[model samples]
Target chain A: MKMTPKAVVIGSLLVLAAVVFVAVILPYADTNQTVPSEIFRSRVSEEAAGRLIYIQNGCVYCHSQSIRKVDWGLGADRIAQAGDYVEDHPILLGSARTGPDLSQAGGEHPDDWHIAHFINPRYTRPVSIMPAFEFLGMDRVATLTSYVQSLGLKAADRRMERQRFWKQEAIKAYEAGPEANVRWLNENVPQGWRDVPNPYPTTEAGLARGHVIYQNFCLGCHGPVGDGMGPAQPWIYPPPLNFTILKGREVSGGVLYYQIMNGITGTAMPYFKRELESQKIWEVGDYVAVYFINQSDANSEPRGIDAAWEP
Target chain B: MSNPSPTYQTAKGFCLTSAFWMIVGTLMGLIGATELVAPDLTKNIGWLVFGRVRPIHINIVLFGFVTPGLLAAAFYYFPRLLKTELYSERLGVVTVVAWNIALVAVVLTLMLGYTQGREYAELIWPIDVAVIVVFLMVFFNFIMTVKQRTEPVLYVSVWYALAAVILTACTYALGNIVWRPSSGALVGIPDAIILWFYGHNVFGLLLTPLSAGVTYYVIPRSVRAPLYSHTLSLLGFWSLIVVYTHIGTHHLLQVPVPTWLKVIAIVDSVAMVIPVMAFLINIWYTAKGRLGEIHADIGAKFVFTGTIMYFFVSIQGSMMSLPDVQRVTHFNNWVVAHAHIGVLGFAGMIALGGLYYILPKVTGRPLYSRLLADIQYWLVLIVSIGFTVVLTIAGLIQGNGWLNGETVYRILPQIHPYYVTRASLGLILVIGAALGFYNIVRTLFVRSGEAVT
Candidate 1:
């Protein structure tokens, strides 16, 4: 096993070339994803710059940029495809998920939520293990938010458009006092949903479990007192639904269950079906029915199939 | 070149402690895996929650167990190969104790629910500091031993061992953000970026280097050949550091971070195959003509298997880093598949191999039973492969189900079967760990041990 300098040098060069080919050359040959020109794609240069920051910081470790057919029931709007990343050079598909996916993150929240999340995850999500990007500076943070907002591409543009439209309306109603704001929010809920009565029973155990679920999942959005003014409310446009608004209304178990499970997609109320179970949904709905709405039809007629454990 | 004979007693002491940690850590892994299947099976105790126990299992195996176990073997062999006795076995023992103390703190905090909640970085700031101290101590001991070496030439293994300790120490400090006791973070998105960079590096650079170091030492030594190519070895070493360092950002591609940074991460992640394949080719080639020789020695057999696992993990890791591939794998058991393959499959195998290789030399006695070690090895290999398969399927089911807009409840029945299978496979690993503990104890403590001859 005699070692020769020539063989050694040749081996080193081969490995070196291989590294260079993949790291530099391959990326150049690949088609890079860019914003579409057809859809009012005004590329916020700042957001584009922030996308670079996202790339640099490894935020993809915890977040994802692609939604799929599996995500629709989880309240996702669209599934990702090759066309979505047509302009991406080194597509931002990340591994390791210490956090949630963000493919359709645009218009999910206002720029303020992005800012808060980027600065420190804990401020937005009490249990967030996603680290803060504040060290990257406000300029960089702004760029990263822009990139996050651009995740869904054309779909994101549409959502952002909706968000912008509703944001103006929300602000106006918010400025007009709580009564007017509640009225505006209820007006947005389809009449059927507004009339739907709670169907599940409000058992003590169910309410207890619901309290825990609410704290873990909903408290961050709907405040402890059922006021929409949760920590994330400021950053959320049409802020979280003030649960109190539904008080004495005809809100039902099915409606609350649907809202909680499906999430008002164009709004900040994310679907919980993917993260929570059926029992959890039913329990949380019951909790809101008894505690927040102050009126519930949970245990009334047409109670569906009574769960095995229920009396 | 020799002073008054140093007793093998010091080396013996470190070996015993290391073997203990290795066995305990593996048991923890078994428990953690089982818990995933039957969440409420363990009395629903807060201390044993998957959230708490999983991290403890991982941390103990990585820090308390594998690192020390491998370092014990490294310390014993590094000095001998360099024609010098260890600079201070006492310091090595102290580091071992400190590491165990850190493990104790980690388990306690996790059980008490005092976690930062980040995957792998669960320990609070104080424990974080303890970890840094332990790493620094280990590094200082290794460096001083190298300085005191009688051998003029530094081997490739020496370089890897040195780089592992030094780089890991720095990464730990920066990743933990030891300065911020309350939060251990920067204010926002930048912090997530920094945290994962350090997190992935823990596996990518630190564990990778240490395992590779042992592989380099074992392959040639067992095959009775000079290293195939020292220059290639060094090249692989440096390239690993370069590519692995930046690829951590690949973990954050989906975030609001800069696209350019994401580009670097994705590209580097793909480029990772270069260093990965290079090392694999070099090692596999070195062992090519001597497969019989490798099989003949039980120690080399384990080490060889470890190298193969390393190949699987690295390839899987690279693929998992791809955005397209991540669409299916991220946030699912697929990454968990990668984690177990990397930690338990690759690093765990390497640590065990190092321990077995050095045990006879350190104890002056043969293994209690070659058959037992062989059985243990097969058990670990088969079970881990099964784990990889079962967990990957579960992750896929979850990923695809969620992506399809299917309700989470709908997918439960589909995924439960895989969970059961994974738990069953985990039991095999647990059995192997227990058997390993018995074997090591017999070899170390039992007198008149049976010899291969």
Candidate 2:
């Protein structure tokens, strides 16, 4: 290896060219052949514009659209496919999950939830570290929401339909007066859940733990006094429920648990089943029952079994 | 040591450019880290948002801070090694001016949200071209210097410096997809393949080799010894280019990229130990029984510590590429920690080392303050290690929490403490950058009454 200027420059250049062919050219040949996935469709102009905003804002750095088989978060139902990104100029299969994967994020919530979320993620997600995008203004925020809603493509559309339907139902119930709203809320719970009481006996520790969960997950939307006057109240429609109205209106512990776990879909309320375990749901439900509703069905009548941990 | 010329205008220009940008780059990092702790700190300031600030921080550190620092050392050494003067001092100065202009454009466009949206490759087509053109300018100047060399045997540092500039020029154009001005990306998954290929190479070819060039040049001279092994140098240089170029796909291992490509990236990533150990062994052995000399020189100390960081980061990289380990590390702050170690701890440390090593020689003056230089070194070293430890813990908490079905939202509160600690450390790093700039400017510009060599 006689060291020469020619050898160093030309030799390294040749190595780079060859590697680019194999690592870059060959893989491009293989992956570029993929057709559209079933959920894949060309974005509408609005969605495309929103994609630009997403790009501009650098959302891809934190919110990944790429879902792996090992993932247990949102969009875990569908493993990402090469076909899924056939139309993306620069596929936004993001590298980090600082936030949830937006692959199937479209239709996960109604557009209203997204709007409120974009303005200040803390409004809807009290614990969110995502920066407030209120500076993007209402129009850009709406556009950004559309792009997020278009994440799962056709799969997202189906979810959107469900959200719209639920949104209408929720608004109608709210307009029907507090009695009707409480009745509709509890009526929606499965009969078995409606009959079941909070399984764990309520204790001071449980309430304290439940208080922490409330502040972390609910206080932003539901308000400090649980009157649904939280900061996000102005943005959300059929706004976060006014818990005081549910008092003495057949709001059982099970109804509270069911509502918390399943969430009032179509509104800004997101399902907690993905995040909260059964105990957390029960605890938070108990907290709401005792503190907000001034009612308690916990550890009373038809209780199946006492948990060992109860003190 | 030899002074081929009385004036080193190009080296001085680059030394100043590196020092100035280091503060801006570290400040951006501090902003991004602070946002993680207090998302509402910036409130409605859209331009200061996390997404935009993050890329600006990364690009500036890579191109603005680290590259120029290494180039400053290269400019000083190229002429010294060749036993001749630089080919064109005027051309070298113009490149410095153009490089700073491009860096300004990088900050402005990204702040205004003019980006291609790809990490590491985020600069739009125009900035990308500017980057390549400037790199070409550097390569042309160096190669011309090589052509007119009085010395027959080209030093190992010369090889690395030349290869890094040329290879980065080509890779920058290719990865950025300079042909496609509208998007600067390929369609579909291939876009990801190309992006990581270019992304990993940014570190693999650009930073690693440039840092290696500085390390190879500075250490042996500081220790007053010939290289421990010519065979090891040959083995290290060629193996680095070969193995590093193949492993960029390791970033896409968890993605929907082809299985065969993933296999290649994994195997090559693991095989990367060959080049890494070769370089480290060569340098460590060269410095053997010469700890006192290395310690006495502020520059050699930083470079040597950088080698230790490189060893940790590279080993961590190899292990991380494993599918099982990636299940926990990928797409999280563990990778962030790994990156901090590689860029800030390894290459960044070496860049400062090279800059410090050449500062007095370029200016023909003593350092403005030895104590201040030592303080900057300690601040940087502490910040890098602190970031790695804090971010890795946060990443593990997130990764493990997610694996057991904990939502990202549920775990935010748990990691807030670590994020706070990271931001606190980032503040120290910014202070370090500011102190370094102050030290460098004073050393280069201040008229001191002290004796001049």
Best by DockQ: 2
Q: What are the per-residue Cα lDDT tens digits for candidate 2 across B307-393?
A: 999999999999999999999888889989999999999999999999889988887777888888899999999999999999999
Instruction: Provide candidate 2's TM-score on chain A.
Output: 0.98
CA shift of B397, model 1, Å: 1.7
- Model 2 segments beyond 4 Å from truth? A305-307, B1-4, B448-453
**Residue A213 in candidate 1, Cα distance off native in Å:** 21
Candidate 2 lDDT by residue in tens digits, A69-102: 8888888899999899999988888888888888
**lDDT tens readout by residue for model 1, B295-381:** 988878888888888889888887877888876676677778877778878887887888888888877778887888899899988
Task: Please give me the DockQ of candidate 2 compared with the native complex.
Answer: 0.89
What C-alpha lDDT, on a 0 to 100 scale, does residue B345 get in candidate 1? 82
Residue A86 error for model 1, in Å? 30
